[model samples]
Target: MGPPERTILGSKASVRRPKERLEREERPRRKITVLPTGRQFAVVRMDPLAMVSHLDLDSVAIEEASAIKPKKYLVYLDAPQDLPLPQSQWCRFWVQPVATTLRPAVPEEGITSDMVLPIHPNTQYAKGRRLMNCTPQFPFPHCYLWIRSMMSLRVRTKRGVDVYDNDKAMTVSIDSHVAFMSAWNEDSRRMFALRRAALSSLSGQTPSSEGKLRKSPSPEVVQPNAEHSPSFATLSIPPPLRIYRDGSASSDDEDTSQASDDAESPHAPTLPPIPPLMALAIDTDVFGWAADPKVPFVPLVDLWFELEDHLSPDNIPSPVELWREQETIGA
Candidate 1:
C-alpha cells in the first residue's frame, strides 16, 4: 500500500491559543469607623442611704446610725455591670480613701490611708452590687477614692495571705462644690435672717468686746477706675452680633460691603443675624489620679452631683430662635 500522505498541519496563525486564567478584580476594602474608647460601667450614681440600709450587718442599730447622719454627705458606689469572665474568676476589688491636695502628692511620701475595704471576687463587678461608701468630708474640699483590683494567690500562710496586684487602679475625685451650692441656695433666706439676728445681738456684748471687734481688720474697698469709665450710652447699648458663616466676627469693611450689596439689590431677602454661640461649661477636675506614682492610676470615672435640668434638650434654644431673641433684645 502506498504510504499515507502525512497529515497537513494548520498554520500557527490559524491555530487557537490556550485561554489565560481571568484576573480577579480585587474588591475595595470597606472603611471602618472607629468608636471613641470608653469604659462599660465606670461610674454611676446611687442613693447612699438606701445602699447602707440594704447591707447585711450584724448590728441593725449600727446600720441605722450609718445611714442616718444629719450633717454628713454620703456617696455610694455600686458595680453597674459584670466584669470580664476571666477577671471575675480571680479579681478582688478594693477601695481606699486617698488625700487630695492642690498639688499632686509624692508617691514616695505615701498618700493612701489605712482604711481599705476589700470586696469579694464574686460580687466585685456584679451589676447593682454595692462596692464602697464615700464621704466627701476631709481636711481638703475634695478627695479621691482609689479603686483597684487584686488577684488572689489562693494561698494561705500563717504570717499573712499573699495577694498579687499589678498596681493598676482608677481614682475618682469627689468634690463638695455642688453639694455646697445646692445647700447654699436652699438656705440663703434663712442664712440672711440669722445674720441679721446675730448683728442685733452683737449690740448686747460688753464695750470691751465691741472695741476688740472694731479693731479687727476691715476688707479693702475696690474703687472703679475713673480713666476707663464706661459712659451711659455704652452701658445701655449692646454690641451688634455680626457673625460670619465660619463663626467669625465680620470686619467693618465686610459689613459695609454687605450693606452696599444689599442696597444695590433692594429686593434681596434679608437673613437674620446669627447670635453669639453659647458655651457649655463642664468640670473636668472631677476625675483625677492620686499623687502616688507607684500605682498606674487611670482617671476613668467622675462622680459628681449634677442637676437633672442642667443640660436638658428642652432647655436648649434652637439656633434660629436664639438669633430672633437676640435681635428682639437688641432692638
Candidate 2:
C-alpha cells in the first residue's frame, strides 16, 4: 500500500493539487464596478483667491461685486470625473462664495479702488456640502450626488468683480497628466525653498499665533560631519590651470597632475559664484509644459474645485491610436 502511494500516479496528484489551488487564487481579481465613473459639475466661477495658499479667509472681503449673482451658465465637467478614490470613493470638493455674503472687503488706505487682487475677498466656501459631496459615503455613497457645482457664482476682485457665466466658460475633459506636478512641487526651487523654510521654522522659533508666515533665517552653509570627509560641498572644480600631456587621473586631488590655483598660471574661466539656491533657481523651468498652449492647465494646488479627478483608474485615458488612412488593430 505504501509503495502504491509513492507511485507516479499519486505523485502527479500531489503536484497538481497545489498548482491548481495557486492558479485559482492567482486569477485576476475583479474590480468592483463604480457607476457614474465620472461627473460633470459646474464651477459657476473660478475664485482667483483660491489660488493662494496660506491665506486667511477672515481678513479678505469683497467690498462690492459686479453682479450679486450672474444667471448665465456655461461651464460643465464630465459627471463624476475620474477621482483618486476607487470606484466608490468620494473626493475633496468645494466651491467659492458658498455663503450669501461676499468675501472680506479690502482696507481702502493701501488698496486702490481698482487693484485686481488674486483674492475673492469676503467670499466664503459654499455651505459645507453645497459644492462637491465631500461627505464620505461607505464605498463613497455621497457619490450618488457625485459632486455638483452650485450655479450663479460671484467672482470678485478688490474693487469690483466679473461674473464667469457658466455658459460662456469652456468645457473641458481632464485625464491625469503623465508628469504630475513634476516641475513645481516635486522638483522646483520655489517649492523646495518653501519646504526648507517650513522645516527651518519648525526646527527653530515658535511661530506667532496670528498665522503669519515667520520670516525664515537667511540660508547658511552647513558643515559636514568628520566621518563623511570629501563631501560634495567641499569638492570644487579644480581650476584647469595646468593641462596634462595625457595620463590616468588620481583618486586624490593632491596626486592629480592639474595645476594649483595660482595667479602665475593660466586660470580657468572665472565662473560666477553658484550658490545652491541660485543653481536650483536657474535649473528650474516651470515653462517646460508651455510649449503647447492646448495642453490643459493643471493647477499646482491639491484642491479639486475645478480640476478633473484623475486619481481613479476609471479616469485613466486610453492610448490614442494614430493612422494615415488605415491602421491595424491589435489582435
Candidate 3:
C-alpha cells in the first residue's frame, strides 16, 4: 500500500500482439545462393494482380514495351515419303502452276496481261505436291498472302487445320488474309520452312534466345572466287557436341588392339565382340556468361513466338497443340 501501488500503464500491453505476430510470420525469406558456383540469386515475387505495382518498383528496370506482332504460319503439302524431289524441281515448281489463280489483297491498277499468274498451277494428280509460290508478274502480288487465305479457309472449314508437332506456330490466329499473303512470297515460305524445322528441333531441347536465331543456317551467301557462292549453311559450324560415344568406341577398339598385342591377358576369350558399336552423341553448345551486369536478355524462341502473335497470323500455333506441349518448349 506504500507509494500508491505503482500503476504501470504501458506494461499492461499483451505479450503477443496480432500485428507483431503477422509481421514476424509473414515476412519474406532472404534470398539464397544458387548451385554449380554458389552466388546470390535474386528473388522476384510478382503477383498477377499486383504486376503493375511490382513493375513500377524503383529497383526494377523498365523496358519499353515492344509492339506485339503475330507470327506467320503457312501450310503446304509435305514431301511424299516415296517421292524424292530434286532441289531444282522443287524451286521450279514454285514459280509456275497450271490452274492456280491470284487475287491480290491490293491489286495495283497498272496490272496488265503480264501481271497475273494467268491460272492456278494444275496440281490435280501431283501426289505430295502443294502450290506455295505466287507468279512474279503480278505487281506486288505476295505468295504468303495467298497461302494465308488458304490457311484461313482451312482453319474455318469442316476439315480443321492439323499442324504437325514440330510446325512453326505463332501466337495470333492465322487469319485468311495473312495466309494468302504468306502463300504469295517465296521468302516467306522459306522462312516458314526454316522456322518449322527449328521448332521441331527445339521442341526436344532447352529453349534459349540466341540459339533460335542461330538455329537455322544463315540465309547469307558469300562468293568464293568470282562466280560461285555458297549459302551460310554450307559453312562449317565447329560441331557443338563431340560424339563421345564414338570416341568411347574408338577407345574400346584401341584397347582391344592393345590386348591382342599382349599375349598375357585374362578373360580375353570372346569379350562379346564389343556389342557391334551402336553410335550415340550428346549434342551440346557452349554458353558464355555476360560480362556486364546491367544488360538483360530474352530468349529467341520467346521473341519469335511473340512476333508470331501480332504481325503475322500464320506462325501462331494451334490452340490444342499449344496447350498440350507448352511445358515442353518455346510454345
Best by lDDT: 1
Ranking by lDDT: 1, 2, 3
Model 2 lDDT, full chain set: 0.25
- Ten residues in sequence with the least summed lDDT for candidate 2: 322-331
Taking all chains together, each candidate's TM-score versus the true structure is 0.17, 0.17, 0.18
Tens-place lDDT per residue, model 3, 125-205, is 222333323212121112221222110000100112421222132112234224433433553444455555555565655
Model 2: per-residue Cα lDDT over 132-210, one tens digit each: 3221211111111101111111122111132222332222233211111121222234334444455556656342331
Scored against the true structure, residue 136 in model 3 reaches a CA lDDT of: 27
Error of 2 at 292 (Å): 41
Displacement of residue 319 (Cα, Å) in model 1 is 36
Q: Which segments of candidate 3 are over 4 A away from where they belong?
A: 1-129, 132-267, 271-307, 310-331
Alpha carbon deviation, residue 329, candidate 2 (Å): 54
How far in Å is the alpha carbon of 176 misplaced in model 1? Answer: 9.6
Q: Candidate 1: which stretches are off by over 4 Å? A: 1-181, 190-250, 253-257, 260-264, 267-331
